[model samples]
Target chain A: MRKLTLPTVLLFIALALTTLSNAQDNIWTPETHMKVKRIGGTAISPDGEYVAYVVTSPVMEGEKSEYLSQIWVAAADGSFNLQYTRGEKSNNSPAFSPDGKQLAFISQRAEKPQVYMMRLMGGEPEHWVSPIPTSSL
Target chain B: MGWSYGGYMTSFVVTRTDRFRAASMGAGLPNLVSMVTTTDISDYLVAHMGGEFWDDYDTYEKHSAIYHFKNVVTPTQVIHGQNDVRVPFTQGQEFYEALKRKGVDTEMIVYPRTPHGPREPKFLMDVSERIAVWFEKYLEE
Candidate 1:
């Protein structure tokens, strides 16, 4: 509605350029990638009440970095979010049983990746099976 | 059922069981011996496979799908990236060749200059379509 003003236009252009330059400077970096929490696997409960997923975060392992993943459960309606598993090594590849009473996941705690099962109600995770090369072959 | 390691899993399961009618393997490490030498994660393979290929031939041979390709009957669609350094295109090439030679229904789709994961939209679409067609052709029967 106002008359053409060169100074006002130049000020707006300068502000836009500064915002663009700031965005360009915030490029993706290793630090940012490390901070990203990766969802390795996810499965919805049969009843559709909760969702099980694996959340992995990068951790400094001496000079190197490694992913430490654990299974987590979240309410379908976003009411609650809780960590379900713990300990060293990674616990990933979550799969909910058809009845939704059990959750199975793979872990490297036994040196080789093995399937472990847990009842959603409560209790310690039990090692269901270790289908390693030696056992399978 | 999987990609990469899952790709390897699909390949392995088909050999042991014919329950799966078809499979889509993406950037999979089929041959552990070649993988240890060719992949960007050579040290990881070497450590996990337990020593170098020369030092542990049994471990490499036992795990390598190339060694067991003769037993695989399920039709497989191997989707790979030409520039995949982690699991080289040669892995997919080898599996496709073996399956073809064995008279198994198989196909290989290599996305040009693509990395481990297909980045280009066109390549991704092509891969998904190819997989769908492969499954439709094999499973629908």
Candidate 2:
């Protein structure tokens, strides 16, 4: 055992106090809400080549605060990660087609929410419509 | 098709199509007007629904599953948390009762002390098993 000097004891107390204060500063609060990142709604490609998920962060718009959500794509092997969609409104609920050639998701780019399909290779997402009106369902 | 919102979708879909043999609705809202009154976000619902129940009764009733229950032929399994406040337990109860009264095959599993969704391990397992059993039974037929 080593002898405890007065300065050494004081030094250990100071370090402990610093850590406690730092932890207190990191407590959850409305001000720290923006610093939090929420991740959810995962959709894996049929071929298992990529994983699509939503990442949301709080945003302050004029007088209101709302979440800004965007879809992110990641390689199955964890080699690459990138933002998949860049729309002004929130984009989420990703679903890949059975053949893995197309990705479908819901977006509000057209004022009303609609299903948009995009090729995994690249290109702008196109609105997917069925032969029958969805409103009839 | 949905969890909370999906449950609502499943409930609405059955009234429109009998193409599905079996469906499971988990914590769904069947009555939009009642939902607005009961939900914690009453003001938010009023804004989303465009107005209060009295202001736009037809719109709320038009989208509500309760009004369309007469057309549902598909067998449905309604699962809900007894303590769910967001969607409330009454929604599931009302749907189940309507199905029963109509002589449609239906079952309701209300997990005690559960909210919105089953978070406890035991309740989760119960829900999974019940779902699997319900689907398998319908598939076998």
Candidate 3:
């Protein structure tokens, strides 16, 4: 090891201080928190070929911030991944049929959250079940 | 399966239908009456439940999944955080016990030091992998 010179030591200190200051400048903020995407509600295909899950992202509109959750499907072998749902409303609770050809989930597109079924081969999601009216509850 | 509201949906849907071969419920509320009293957000649950559970006992019972457990035939895997205050761990326990007693295949896993959901990356991955395995086991006919 070489003996450290005063000038070299001072140069190292300066670099360390600069890095610390830069880190402080990049401290976490509310905006930073909002940018994070969360994944949940995972379901596996019957054949274990694909996994369906929900990705929740924060949307900032004017001064209001809202979360938008959409279903996503990915191959279990990590071959391909794709978003299974879109639009402004939130969709969640993905479940696969025993046949592995269809996916069932809850969507908030209607007045209330309803169950939807979509084919794996491709096509639009079908609104399947609507909850009982609140009046009955 | 799902967490929080999604968990609630899983429990509720399983009671209404037997389409799914297997399901994993994460921090789900199966009993609205117990959930309203035990959850941290009692007011929110009460508002959604239509009123105080005591005031509308019939309505609460009718809406709760536990009341319709006899109709559930699908095997369910229940996962919950021991420290969860939002849905309460007892919800998962109750559902699991009910299914087990009914001879409907069921299992419950409790994670210590966790809240409404698993926050650690390992716990999250474990949940995903375990659920996948559960579906595979039951879906295989």
Isolated chain A TM-score, each model: 0.75, 0.80, 0.80
As for candidate 2, its clashing pairs are B2-B6
Q: What lDDT would candidate 3 get against the real structure?
A: 0.87
**Compared with the true structure, what per-residue lDDT tens digits does model 1 show for residues A1-137?**
99869999999999999999999888654445455677868899999999999997766656434558899999999999999988878888889888889999888888688899999867988999856563652
How much lDDT does candidate 2 score? 0.85
Query: Model 2's CAPRI class?
Result: incorrect
Estimate, for each residue in A53-107, the C-alpha lDDT of model 3 and write its tens digit: 9999766666434578999999999999999999989899999999999999988
Clashing pairs in 3: none
Over B1-141, each residue of candidate 1 has an lDDT whose tens digit, in order, gives 457898888777777878888888888878888887789989998988779999778888888888877789988888889999988989888888888999988888888878998765445445666777889887788
| lDDT string, candidate 2, A1-137, tens digits | 99999999999999999999999999754446446678998999988999999997765556434566788889999999999888568787889999988888877677566778998768999989633344642
